[model samples]
Target: MKYISTRGSAAALDFEGVTLAGLASDGGLYIPESWPRFSDNEIAEMAGLPYAELAVRIMAPFTAGSLTEEELRGLCHAAYGSFAHDAVTPLVQFDQQHWLLELFHGPTLAFKDVALQLLGRLFENFLSRSDDHLTIVGATSGDTGSAAIDAVAGRERIDIFMLHPEGRVSEVQRRQMTTVLAPNVHNIAIDGSFDDAQAMVKRMFTDPSMATSHGGRFRITAVNSINWARLMAQVVYYFAAALQLGAPQRKIAFSVPTGNFGDVFAGYVAAQMGLPIERLIVATNVNDILHRALSSGDYSAGTVTPTAAPSMDIQVSSNFERLLFDAGGRDGAALAEQMRGFEASKAMQLTNAQREGASALFTSARVTPEEMVKAMRWASDHCGEIIDPHTAIGLYAACSMEIDAAMPIVTLATAHPAKFPDAVSEATGQHPELPARLGNLFEREERFDSLPGTYEAVRDYVAQRATESA
Candidate 1:
């Protein structure tokens, strides 16, 4: 599949090029030129497939000639074999109508692991033999940092530097990323929020003179959802959950606790690929820009306030670029205007077509912190489920939405509850237990470089690190 920039200006590229170049030169996410579709019968035939097998089957079309099916399956099998659960993403029947998709069973204990683990393997497979190296820069509110570090740590050809707002993430979340002692791994403690970190990463790409590789053969890529491979890997569980619930025979709905809109947009990609999914529920915390945009058809940004759900405390949802592309009336110039407006005035004018594209397959709700606490307690009482703050918001919204039981409304349980022990403990009166593998996390010494929210500071830091590594 050929990938095109969502801004509609950059030249189109295939799977490998897009995978290697996380964000396009024009500062837009890459999307397939044409979606690869699967028939209802074929989707039906995927029933009873193992998670890894199902992933290879669902993703093969997108990665078609870049990596053969057998190679992809090998990578999938290896990536998932180390997961804590046999079913990489196990579906729990929260209720007859409601199900919680357990996505935290992988190495880093978050939904990102479901994709980044595979992405790490894919990058190794593709880049190892070429004598070229990569420096990965990612911004995380909580989970993505640790997941990326886990996937990229100890790799000789890749150096990953993960940035997070110093005091924003939970202790476990911070520990998860900062405790990694690999030579190729680095954790950046930025004195700002996730938006600041993300902006820095984007600026690193936008700076025309920024060079990651001294030899010029090495390049930069992201393990963030901006990366096509990350999104492609995330699309698997949508199909897996749909197939598990009888997709062609019945439809499904997803209540995704989204941060950057990448996870929920994966559901949209599934819908585009002919998965029989009804409305995709856009679940969010109090910092709910997308929800308000969907309800009013006016896209705008506000000061991102910190909530119990720090991960979703983002104002500029990056993946919305793809939705704007899907909306189609807006071209590069229009999108350029929209983004420039958002950056300056903290809001933008979105056309009815842009809103329609979002509203067609998506409906939204903003769950309060109080509601999240109650939902966590309620789920613990009712279904013996203890979800993280973000996931609890989704469950709360799912319980309230006019959901169809027959359609199997699957909620994406984005992170492990242990990531937010204080919230989980206060809500359920029991500390969410950590996995044994991460048991030593609290005692590990954190190593990170703290920096102010300045593009020059970030550029200098990364440049110095590149020089030392060389």
Candidate 2:
């Protein structure tokens, strides 16, 4: 299998190549050359397998030229073994119509651990075959920093530098990243929104001076959703949830609370791969750029509002470009021109093809704080479930969907309730206790740097400290 840049330019790469090269050289995200499809019998055979084995099967197509089945299986087992739950990503049924897919079982207590755990292993596996070392640069609103940091920290061949908006994240969210204290993990708290940090990270990927300052071996990769491998890893859970709920013979719907579009886009990939999906619900908080884009043709950015769900407080979603490129006829040049226009201004209207194609599979809703809290209360009172603010948005959206009574709607539980205990307590009148594994998180010594939100300041900081690849 080969990966092509969403933009018309950059050379095609195999799985390993794209895994190492996060963003395309021509300023586009990488996507598979074509969607890999499975027959009904093929998908049916995937039932009842363990999570590790299932991941190996679903990811085999994308990793064809890179990893053998045995190799991939070993990596999968090693990566998922650390999850607190045996199911890896367990599903909890609320009622006949609604369910929650718990994705915070891994070390970081966020959905990102599902992918970054395997991503860290992949980086180690690939780097073992060569002399090259990786300098991973990533930006996160909340969870991605901690998950990515936990994944790659202390690895001999990789050094990770993660940036997050300083005061925008919850106390648990911030400490999860700051308290790791790994020498190889460099955490930066930038004085801006997540979009500003994300823009700087993107700029670093293509900056000429960043490359020239270090030697020819200066290698920089990504841990964000901009990396195809990370997004590809996320696709397996959609299949896992659907197969359990009855798939191949039945269609399942998923509601994903996403700001960056990566998690929900994985569902779109599953549907493209012949998984029987009824719809992919794009759930957003007050920061509703994605909600506006899918509901109407308007894809515009506004000021980032600090929300209870800090992870969803993003204006510019990096992975939405992949959807636009695919749904808009895969005409890279045309999409590139369209993207350029959007970058110049902070807005663009989705084309007829893009709008129509997206509407066929996706429906979106924006949840206000009041509705979010109500959903949390409903879960507590009715279902005896304590949910984080992010999951509440998804559940509220799922309940609002006018779908068949027989159909099952799964809401992606993106984070642990303890991660946002204050918000959960305010809504449900119950303070969530941290799991035993993280009970002492607040007692750990924290370490990180504070920097102004400027491209040059961040660039110089990373450049001065980034290890030169050998």
Candidate 3:
């Protein structure tokens, strides 16, 4: 259960180490050296298991000696018991063959809560014992900020700073982050796009001087899928979804809306673990670099166009490094060269081996803004089901692909439609009502730190917060 950096330079780490170190020091994501497999019996037993207990079963292998099965189960149950749904991630049959895995019934009303909630508790457990305080900085286009804030806010051992594109998120999305009054949480409205905010967060983490100057008193981490725990928790729903729909008997496929590639990458990890999945479809909006990469082997960033699905507007997909690590094509230097080339030139090419790796297990497709809205209408009109813009991209991408009657498909409904009220209302002719918990979001005053979008600027801001007394 050792984790190794994709770039092949950083020291191999264990589960907790990988969880705390979101991105590798070599600017790569950490991936498990070997995937853990579950017996058919274990998969069968997943039925009727509590969400937290299921998570422990699915994640125990990845954690190795970090926590025993019983300890992990306790942590997971404590974490998810507060969620809004009884089933945690419930399955709803949209049609006879197609189904929606409802993942938005948590505190923040996004699939992120499935993992971020547990991540917060894990951090509290690990950090409190060591008396080590953490400064968590994350960049989100939509749901990540709210989920991160909701989980980390008011915690004694951590201070969180989240950045989102100033004008890009929906009004509800922005308000969700802005209205939190937790003294330990801060939200930033970056002047540019989601990519800009993501880039800044990475720059801060990569700054060697920031770590040296922090005097070892302050630790920096992330809540994004860059965190291994986030990805680990996400992987459970994939297995649970497949099992509920008949996994070993019926091959399952997932259609995940692409952004930073974390969610889809989770399914990829599951496939590598020899889960009986048919296909892992990578769906996207106009920010379709991953889609293009899969279709034609071209990894190039087009302009980050602002769309109703702003969460998918990322040009730099972070979790792709893990895929490349397992893709089995090139050495570390060659992979590093490709990564640097993309960062510098905004484009990179996948070699034959790399392309084959992607082709082996994943398919890619893109949807336009117009198509997303249309599909939302079509799904609701034809099936009486409303989809959020992000989920709409996933639904259309899943539908547009050649229908394979051999396997049932599960589309990752990434966010609650209420998060994008305007887009959903326009497409479905009805606005989604927010959960009762979020009813007073507009009334709370938020606290946050703002800085220029640069490595030094953010590094200094993180340092200052880490020095603050709770």
Candidate 4:
């Protein structure tokens, strides 16, 4: 269960250390030294377990040295107990071959809740054992900020500072992050795109001056998928969906509405663990860096364009590096050199090994706005289901991709349609209503800071506000 940086320089660490150190000191993401695999018999044995019990079995290996089995099970139960659905993540059949896995049943009503709820608990559990306090800094295009905030707000030994693009997200998305007035939550609207905000967050992780400025009293961690624990929790639902469709005897294909590439990468991990996966489809909107990178060998990032699916409007996909490192034969030094060139020029060509390795299990689609709308309309008219723009993009890919007709294709429904009401109404002529729990979201008083998109400004604000000790 040891973790190593994608760059070959940092010391190997266990799960607790990697959980706290979001990015390695050498300016690279952390990954397991080697993947943990399961046998087909083992996978079959887990067919009908409850979500929490199945989560313990799937995640226990990764947390071996950090948490005991009982402690892990308790944490999983406490984390998922608040979810609105008994299934946690439910599957709805669209047709004989097409299905939608609804992942917005938790408090924040987005796929991120599936992981962040547990992540917040893990942060508290590990921090309480020692005396350290965490200053969590994260950037989100839409859902991550709200979900992460809801997970950690007012919790002990933690303070969260979240950044999102100002005036770019939908009204519901903006208010979802700003309306939570917990004393430990600080929201910032940065004048930039999600890529700019993400770059600033990464720079802060490596900047020695940020630590010195705070007198080294508090450590900074991340809530983004760059943190391996977030991705680990995500791997469970892939197994859940597959097992429901009779896995091991039947192979399942997943179409993920990917922006950061974290969710689809979880499916890849499931396959690595010997789940019977047919394919992992990476679906994207007009901001299609992932599709371009997979369909061709081009890995260059362009300007991010705002679309109906604001969450998918990201030019740079951070988690793609972990895939490249694995696909490039886990040679940290070689991948490090390649990553540095991409960082300097914002472009790189995929190597033969990387391209061939990824082609074995991954395919991609880039959906236009017209096609996205059409998909939404089709879902409403044909299946009687109104979907958000992001889910529509994924549904489009699932229907159009050339997969075997006998295999079940599950599209990850990443968010609630109510979160993007305007776009859903425009496409389906139906205005989805917010859940009763969030019925009063519009009336809540909003509080947040409008800041210039600079590392110095964000650093000073966090320095002045974060608690020195828990």
Candidate 5:
């Protein structure tokens, strides 16, 4: 399967090329030239398969020409073998209508583990074929940094430099990234918001100076959702949840707590692949650029507001461009022009086509701190489940929507409650303890550096330390 950039200018790439090249050279995201659809029988055949087996079936189409089915299955099993649960991503019923898909079962205890674990292995497999070194530059709000770090730490032929906004993430979130002292892992605390760090990451991809620093053989890639492989792995869980809830004959709705838009866009990709999805609810916190854009066609970035849900404190939703490109008739040139304008002004209006296309299977809601806390309390009091703030926001939105009463809504439990103990404690009057598996996270020694949030600062830091390709 060939992947094409959202902007028309970049050469089309196969899955391996796209996996190694996170962002398109023309400042666009890569999407499959065409979505591979499954017949009803094909999707029905997927039911009851183990998570690893099911992953191979769903991802086989996308990984064509890069990995054999056996090779993909081996990677899937190896990646998921460390998950604490056999189900990998388990489902918990909250009530008659609402259920939670628990996705924090892996080593890092977040939904990102579902993909980054496999991504790290993919990097190892591909890089082993050649001596070319990969410098993975990524930006994270809370979860991505830790999950990505955990995945790639100590691996050969790879060095990861992850940047997070200093003092903006939860204590657990920060330590999860910083405590891992693997020589290949470099965590930088930037004095800015997630958007600033994300902007620098994106800029590094296009900056010629960055390429010059690494010399002839070094290539800079991404571990962020901008990577198609990461996003592609996320699509499997949607199928897992939907099939378990009776798909093919019955449609399922998912409520995703997303800040980067990658998680929910995976749902969009599942829907494109002919999964029987009734609706996808895009859940957001106080930084409601996604909510505003979906509801009123106003795609604009506002000032970052630090909240209990620090992960969602983002104004620029990077993956939103993928949706716009797909929904806006795949007119890359037009979308590129639109994006250029938005970049210059920090805002843009969604066209009629984009709005209409998105509204077909997508709905959105913005949750407030009060409502999020209320949901947390409701779950604890009524359902006997204590949830993290981000999951509570998704549950709040799921309850607020008026979907068919007979149909079930699954909220994506994005992180472990212990990761944000203070927020969970404040909301439900219950302090969550870290799982034994993550032993003494706070007590572990951490290594990282603080830098001003400038592209130049980040570029120089990475260039100085990143290994030159062999």
Candidate 6:
């Protein structure tokens, strides 16, 4: 499958090229040139398949020219083999219509592990075939740093530099990234919000000097959802949840607690692929640019507000561009012009075509702290499940949306409750403990560097430290 940049200038690329080049050279995201659709019989045939097997079936289309079926299956198995659950992404019924898809079953205990585990392997696999090395520079609000670190730590031919907002992340979240002392993992505490860090990361990708500054030794890449491969792996879970609840015949609705917009976009990909999807609900915390964008066509970003759900406290949703490009009829040049206006002014109204296209299958909700807490309490009192603040936001949206009583609505449980113990405890009066595997996380020694949030500083740090590949 070939991929094209949303900005119409970059050369069309295959899956491997898209994976390595996270952001297009034209400063737009890459998307599949054409979506691959499946027949009803094909969808029906996926039932009862194990998670790894199902992943292979669903992802094979995107990786057609990049990886053979056997190689892809082997990578999937190796990636998911260590997950804490057999189902990989297990579904728990919260009520008759409402259910929670637990995605924190992997080593890092967050939804990102579902993709990054395989992404790390893919990087290793592709890099092994050639002599080129990867210098992965990523910006994370909370979970991505730890999950990406866990996935690539100690791996050959790669060095990762992950930036997170200093003093903003929860204690568990901070320690999770800092405690991993792998030689290849370099954690940076940026003295700014996640949006600032994300902007710097994007700038670094395009800065001409970045390529020549590091002795031209290493190629920079991303682990963020900006990478198409990250979103590709995420599409599998939507299919997994739907098929288990009855798909191919009955439509399913999903409420995703979104900050970057990548996860819900994955559901969009699934629907495009002929899965029977009723709706894709985008859930957000107080940083509700996505909610406002969808609700009123006002796609404007405001100041980032730190909330109980730190991960969702992003004002700018990077993956929103892909949706706009698709909704704008895949006219890359037109969308690129539209995006330039937003980048200049931090605001843009969605066009009629874009709004109408998105309105068909997408809806959004902005959950308040009180509502998030109430959902947490409800889940604990009614369903006997302690949920993190992020999941509570999604659960609130899932319950509030108007859907058929028979149609199952699955809320993506994005993180483990223990990752944000204080928030969960405050909301549900139950202090969720870290699983036994991470029981000693608090005692581990932490290591990371604190850096000013500037592209120059980050670029200099990476240039000096990143190792050259032979």
Q: Please name the candidate that would achieve the greatest lDDT relative to the true structure.
A: 5
Q: What tens-digit string does per-residue lDDT give for candidate 4 at 193-311?
A: 99999998998898878778776678999999999999999999999999999897999999999999999999999998889898999999989999999989899999999999999
Candidates' RMSD to native? 1.4, 0.9, 1.6, 1.0, 0.9, 1.0
**Overall local distance difference test of candidate 2:** 0.94
The weakest ten consecutive residues by lDDT in model 3 span 446-455
Report lDDT per candidate: 0.86, 0.94, 0.83, 0.93, 0.94, 0.93
Which residue segments of model 1 deviate by more than 4 Å?
Answer: 212-217
Candidate 2 matches the true fold with a TM-score of 0.99
Q: Candidate 3: deviation at residue 77, Å? A: 0.5
Q: In candidate 2, what are the lDDT values of residues 1-470, reduced to their tens digit?
A: 99999997999999999999999999999999999999989999999989999999999999998999899999999999999999999999999899999999999899999999999999999999988878999999999999999999899878888999999999998999999987788899999999999999999999999778877565899999999999999999999999998888999999999999999999999999999999999999999999999998899999999999999999999999999999989999998899899999999999999999999999999999999999999999999999999999999999999999899999999999999989999899999998999869999999999999999999988887884423
Which candidate would rank higher by TM-score, 3 or 5? 5
Looking at model 3, the pairs that clash are 186-448
- Which segments of candidate 4 are over 4 A away from where they belong? 467-470
lDDT of 2 at 143: 96
TM-score of each: 0.97, 0.99, 0.96, 0.99, 0.99, 0.99
Q: Residues 1-470, candidate 3, lDDT per residue (tens digit)?
A: 89887788888998888877788888877888778887677677777777778788888899877877877888889888987888888887767667788889888888998899989988887786687878888999898999988888898878888988887888788888888887787788766778888888887788887677767776788899888889989998998888888876678988999799999999988877657888888998888899888888888887898888988989888888778767855366678777888899988887888889888889988898888988899878888888899999998888888867656889988888888888999888998888888877767665555566655666566667667643
Sorted on lDDT, highest at the top, how do the candidates line up? 5, 2, 6, 4, 1, 3
Clashing pairs in 5: none
